[model samples]
Target: MLMNSNYKVAFFDVDGTLADNELPRELGIYGRIPESAKRALSKLKEAGIEPVIASGRNYEKIADFAELLGVDSVISSNGTYVTFQGEPVANHYLSTELVKEMVEQFQTKQTDFLLETPEEILEYAADELLPENILQFLCHCPKEDLPSLDTEKLIAEKVAPTALNIHYKHVSKASGVEEILQKMGISSDQALAFGDEENDFAMFEKVGFPIAMGNGNDELKAKASYVTDTVKNHGIWKACLELELFEEE
Candidate 1:
């Protein structure tokens, strides 16, 4: 059953939307939500809007951010997983064949990466590209502290992967978003999303309103419904306010 316009949901991207990109790169470590952004989120909730933190991070990691924002529902792992109030709403594991293929491909390309199962994040070819600070923040380990896993052994044990992430190449976040919407008894047209990256394009196709941050990639900005200020500049809040997401208090 599709509810009309009065029922609305807002999906937020983590790194560039709510939290600053915590990953260390030349991009540096983006910090927590600024005061103004926090205020905006609070105002949105007060207006009876359902605010959801949607990101590529794992279910456990992003749960904390959802707590900070006081949002109970989240679509994590680029939509490969979702949860609400500590209950599993949906879970999508990569096909075993696909997992093996990705591992083989990453090895061939010598790319730095990790794999996430429902339980742990396994590091492989891990180097400076997967920084300690970010690992500590996301998985509670210093990069040096991570343990190596035997992918071959895991295959023998028939282990399942919750999701696959690489330095480059894979399906878009949109695929996960669509799967989640279908599982949740909702349609893409019922939701709005904010994101900033090449990875976010597929999701934009299914959403009712796609907002690109001012700092988003050029291609994403070109496809967005509106290009707003940078995340650091409180672009999301400004755009939401302009869109009447909240009645100005």
Candidate 2:
């Protein structure tokens, strides 16, 4: 396989993309990165393509994983915080007023939720023990039981809740990727993105080539430019090989 210089950067979703969608037993611990996936990332680096972890997990949760994978750039917290090459690129936080309103609404409905900040995750009327690896804000609530928010109010306040329950109308994985692209002075057409969930839709829209894992959401697969194998079957390696994103040594 020959390297494809057309892609200068690759954005990778964490859960169900780079790592298996399994619950971890310990806090901040994640499933091992498949050896093949590691090799593929190395090859990308050798081919002069930057591989970045773009996940819904907060920076604190994904930092160790990123370090283990040897990737310095990351888009975390559903695009609320981003760092490129170990340098802060952007941090888009939910407005204080919006947070207060959401908290009140959640309390009124007795919904279990957690508030995520750059520093830590705060429990807000949550009853169950916090999971070792908390991915999103909403917890232990069924889709039907989820509290209804004032859509009009949210729009008027210029704030939107993401699929991951992140409240930031101006922030998303796409927005984070855009920041990195601008910093690298590369066009979106030169970027490749891989994702496996509904939250990843925004990211898929921002990239020239979008790949969906075999075990990914059906809707995501439909939007993907290419669909590869499951993460357990070394999908990252297979996709890079087929796309010629990196040369096999």
lDDT of 2 by residue, 111-144 (tens): 7677676657877543643333332354455445
Q: How close is candidate 2 to the true structure, as a TM-score?
A: 0.79
lDDT of candidate 2 vs native? 0.76
Instruction: Rate residue 21 of model 2 by lDDT.
Output: 62
By TM-score, the best candidate is 2
Tens-digit lDDT track for model 1 on 142-241? 3333233334422211112322333112323565566556655677777788888776777788788888988889999999988889877888788777
- In model 1, what are the clashing residue pairs, if there are any? 174-203
Q: List the global CA lDDT of all models.
A: 0.61, 0.76
Off by over 4 Å in 2: 1-4, 22-30, 108-110, 124-139, 142-164
